[model samples]
Target: MIKTKTLFTKLFLSYSMIIFLSFTLFGLVFIYIFHLNLYDDYEELYDFHYERLQEQIAQSAEEGWSDEETADLIQPSLHHRNYNIFIYDNTGELFIQPEGDAEYEPDQEIILTASDEFVSEGATMNGNLSYIIADSFSVPGNEETYVAVMVFHDLNHQYQQMALMVLIPFIITIAFSGGIIYFISQKITAPLRHMNEAALQLATGDFSRRVTVSSRDEIGQLGDTFNYMAEELNSLEKMRKEFIANVSHDLRSPLTSMKGFIVALLDGTIPENKRDHYYLLMKEETERVIQLVNDTLDMSRLEAGQIEIAPAPYNLTRQLQRIAVLLEPQLERKGVGIQLEPEDTDLFVVADKDRIEQALVNLLHNALQFSLNGETIRIQLETTGDMLAVHVQDEGKGIPEAQLKHIWERFYKGEKSRTGKGGTGIGLSIVKSIMELHKTEITVKSKLGQGTVFTFQLPLKK
Candidate 1:
């Protein structure tokens, strides 16, 4: 169904046109530059021979030499190059002629024109046809002026045969060149044609569409790049569908709870003595909905490159301590404790402090979500070369290896926590975005029964 097939057609037609124009240009060059006009060269050669012979005959003429005797003197030498001459008088009587189809005469105008000074017609003759050139010449002052005419025979036809011999091969070459052009154009445009079809499928929301790459040339590279784009687009499309479904489910929870609380209160099911408790719970649900919306907006802004990181020097160790203190209540409720490595120490780092704080809180909260009772979540700091590494380790039901790659995706509730965990499912995604803003990445190491560790790096303050 791909209708945009013009690239091949355009390439084919353009290459053919270029080849055709090249052929025409080469033909002109061959004719003009390479001495292919044999007809004119032959005619000029005959004229030169006639001039030399006539000069000899005029200089060698004797008293009372008949016109016929002059003709015999100027007769064709052996191995004639297909040319002859004639002599005549002013009355237009032919005194001498050549062996040919003999129905010719000298015109009276040519006879009169040559009476005083020598005159000759220089017009080119037709193919193999003979013509007359009348001129009367006498050596200086002798009263014996005779009309002489030279005839060129078969030179034009001979030139035509030579040209035909060359042109037949040239025509064959042009035809062969057309075939070569057709194949080359197809080979060049083949990938583009496939890409066009794939692109059309992409337009119809078929992100799985891909092109075949057969070579390492530019066209093949383009095909490989297109397939990569399609794969990423397909992943994004899946994420889009998942995000919509999760948002609907998350919104329905808070909304349904609020609706239930309202129905109970309006019908006096929640008694006046217990109304305050129900009101507090409804407010909490409303706050949860607001937090969900804000988190989605935060992810959106981060992904759209709208949130610029404002980095500065900060005490990273102090920041981690403060985050642990702020989460003291949640840690207490979960029966988990936070322990800082090499306690009572401080280290400085350069980063966006507020964003880093957000990341730490999210990681700690995630640990609190899955940590068993009486488990100690450890926060460690180490320096290696130019950067400082921070690790958050927890004694929790660790993520599956297959699920680890997806933990940072929005709404990715892995198999372990998907059933029991009460999370908005974007906490790790926000943490990942924050680390990316610092020009680094967060990595996780975990096993099925063991705990998980989340590690990232920050630029140490110099």
Candidate 2:
């Protein structure tokens, strides 16, 4: 992958090149178009006078004027018009080169007609490119008289100066626009650089790192999303660390107790009269360890999508009653009562029987765990439209509003300390996964002082 600094450089240089190219192309096209549109007027004016001069020479010959008189008639006008006039006689000899030292020549010569115009490209005395426009007309005695005009490229030279005049602004505009593009590129790459830094921190297990976001554009939204992801990862990391500590305590305490009990039994420190009680205590500790491992494995499997649910019709109300019976011992120990609301009715629902059973066991266990003595946990059933809804509501110490949302996350027991209780922490997550596999959702409604009602619905069998 390319470094962010290199990426910024690429963006800056690419934008600068585009702006530079655009200005260069625009300047060139503007000058070329202006040159073509304004080019021909000077040449046309010179050709007009050459033809008129031909007519004047013809009239002078008819009236029998002398060469000196003819020269006196048109000499000043010819110099003012910047023309080098020529006259060719019948034999095609060098007839008259007026303005005697005019070092100019037309590359070709031709006879004249009413609409005849001849233009030849030639060079001036200083070797600069020039144009010669020539015309000939008939005079007295069947003489062939031609007039040639030489005009240097001073117009094109003026166009060159004009191009230079426009070029200064173009260079200045390109430089200014390049600066603006660099600023915009900085704005674009700054957020990405921050995100890259945060990502590196994240890779190093620093989930607390976050990017600053301010704009409302797509980049801003990306920054916002990155920060949100970091928050969630921080939360999950916290949960993971807590879970590890809890699991460690849970395993170590049980194993330590079991080991102590075994050592006592092996050494006969536990009297024969109390050996049975010690054995039972050890067995209970072993069961706790087994339960913790099983719950952890179940959560992993569910999250990995390794557990597939098979939906079939089952009596949901009867299942709830069975769960109540199975948890009767815990209820009795807590002096709690399990009551089923409208228990006489049968509700058939489409769900995986084993998965639903697993889910009900967890919910009832949780409800009983938080419950106080003489508190009744109500298992309510009803047909809501096309589905049968089962609500396991508990009269225990209700969960706080803040922790209610995270109840279904793995190892997220809001109160954290579950001393003297049997909870593997991922029970609610397993239940939620089971419900989701049945194409349904488990929802909770609770207040801090009031109670919590866990509700889940399954499709009713028709």
Q: Give each model's whole-structure lDDT.
A: 0.75, 0.76
Model 2 score (lDDT): 0.76
Worst 10 residues of 2 by lDDT: 106-115
Return the lDDT, model 1, position 196.
Answer: 91
Listed per model in order, the count of residue pairs whose N, CA or C atoms clash below 3 Å is 0, 0
Model 2 Cα RMSD, 1 decimal:
4.1
Question: What TM-score would every model get versus the actual structure?
Answer: 0.74, 0.83
Q: Candidate 2 on 325-356: residue-level lDDT in tens?
A: 87776688789998898889988888899989
Candidate 2: regions farther than 4 A off:
1-5, 47-55, 58-104, 109-150, 273-276, 417-424
Backbone clashes in candidate 2 total: 0
- Candidate 1's residue-wise lDDT over 1-462, tens digit each? 533456767776777678777767776676664343444554466557557655756655644467566666665541245655666555667655665635344456666776665554434444335444445655544555556665555545654765776588778977898788779878988888889999999999999788989999999889989999999888777777767777777789989999999999999898899999899889878977887898889888988989989999999988888888978877887789999996677788999999999888888878877788999999999999889999999888788788888898876667346337445577799999888888898999997677899999998899
For candidate 2, the per-residue lDDT at 257 reads 96
